[model samples]
Target chain A: MPHAIKMQDKYGKDGFVALLLESQGLDASDIPGFMWKRFPTNKTWLSTSGDAPFQMTGGGLPHAALVGVDGTLLWEGNPNGAPKKIEEMVEAELKKSKSGWGKGAIAKKARGLLYGKNAFVDAAKVVADALANAKDDEKEDLEAVAREIELRREAFKKAPKVLSEDARYLEGVKAAENYAKWVKGNPEWENEANAIVLDFQRPEIVKELDLEKGLKKILASAGDKAPTADLAKSLRTFAKKNDGSRMAARATLLAAAAEFDPNKK
Target chain B: MTLSRLVRGVGMVVVLTTAALAQLKVGELVPDKTFAQMLNSDGRKSMAELKGSPVLIDWWGNH
Candidate 1:
């Protein structure tokens, strides 16, 4: 665990994430950062869990695995025996991160297409083939990496305006949320997600995030006591105020329901 | 190292075992696995969730 911490402290900022998997049946105090350990939440280790046992070779203390940005296992063995080899592999993977990948539409479409198909090594041929059948608008979005060094620089760019420009406030917010699931081990892209959320921070946009929470109470929660006409008017108002939002769609449905509810008209 | 080597350090694909998840081998796709019950990771919870960088997973027992 201490060795893990040392590697983490040095390369963590450069996107080298050190995950310490403490095997079961030992005092938690033995972990490297013992004082900082949080319990109950972090107790179970999944790889060796009964549900799906991971087959780790060299059944001994301090075995390690190095996984790359593309989810390929680069190397795995006793760290003590191959420190130089491990570092060498880490360096090679780092170059990929610093030069490869893109964000926003480029990521969601280009790199995503390649990675989803596990055809990253053959990215150019895949893109060229896909382009042959793509529509005009989709064609504009397609870009291929002809060579490893020429991996599109757009991978690290700021949240593209296409992510938020002219889309409904919530749709824009969702774009940022989706990207949150993609990028990792850095602040620049996370900060980009924050900037995107800020782009849609208008009072109306924030209210839309919780539209359903407030809608039913205004539209029908008063039971039969609430006037049918007044409830209908409020529902209409809420829907109109939040037009194009998902909650607005629900509000429209409830507004129509007012047409048949009993309570003496 | 060559450019392809830098982007992807392709090596011999050594399938260590016959199980669903072959043992950690260079240049082979790692089977996606969830790492639940993590004590702390700034909100990251799995190997799949942590992409766009190199990940060093040190599996050790407290002996």
Candidate 2:
């Protein structure tokens, strides 16, 4: 039986890339650019500016009371009290590590600016500003850029759609299968099999669909009252056997789950 | 030997003293009991819980 791996231990950068390639049919090389664009650096002055006041308060300055010019506090404290200052608070905050902010935050915000709100208008202005003093030959390239921008703008203007919860479970199941294959091909990864299992059986993912109950229902329908461990094993085996179609089916299920109506269905 | 050098040394000492006072030292944890309670009860607890479980905690600001 293929052991489960923890998502945190197994679903790291490399694992995520592998899963995207296997399940979403995305190339690892193509992923980096999309990931990068989706999560552009907060180091940029604009992104960093939004966080400066918060960081100041986090690092120990009473930004609201002390930093605020008005009656309101400038920055609210982390649910906890403010961080302590070792030296100049501003300098210390600027120097702190920038690893806490994840790709999701950047992606969500970038997507909002690019597709949500009036991102297209804002982008058009930026493009216009960039092309204002370009050479005559550069005009064609600028126009092409504008066209591409318009296409993206239209794409963003459309409603926000996310994968369904059921599809996500199937993706998790597919990821588990891929991890099993990778482990089989590369025996060296066997030591990390348990971590890999945990990754596939991520509590958050399971919690999203009430998977424990769903799996039980599926098992009950099949007239099998086996333990959860056995059911999980059976499901993993089924997913592995049905590879490609399973991934698609999983994606569909997830899309449906995302827009699921428990009251109706 | 020079007045400028003497003034620079005094300035360094004052700066260092202020920095030392601002910092939360190992021994100073006793003096700031409320601060320590807040840190342990509210701040550290969440981090510890996240570390113990496979949960993703996002730290963000409204501004």
lDDT of 1 by residue, A1-265 (tens): 5555656666665667776666654343233123123221222222333222245677776788888877787787888787777777777777666555543344344454344332342445445666677666556555423332133222322223332222233444655555544443336655765665576677766676567567856834545342365676788898899898867775675566454332221
Error of 1 at A40 (Å): 19
Residues B1-63 of candidate 1: C-alpha lDDT, one tens digit per residue: 788765554332233234544465578777755554343343344565556567877776534
Model 1 residue A182 lDDT score? 46
- What does the interface RMSD come to for each candidate? 7.2, 20.7
lDDT (C-alpha, whole model) for all candidates: 0.54, 0.30
Off by over 4 Å in 1: A27-53, A101-265, B1-22
- TM-score of the second chain in candidate 2: 0.36
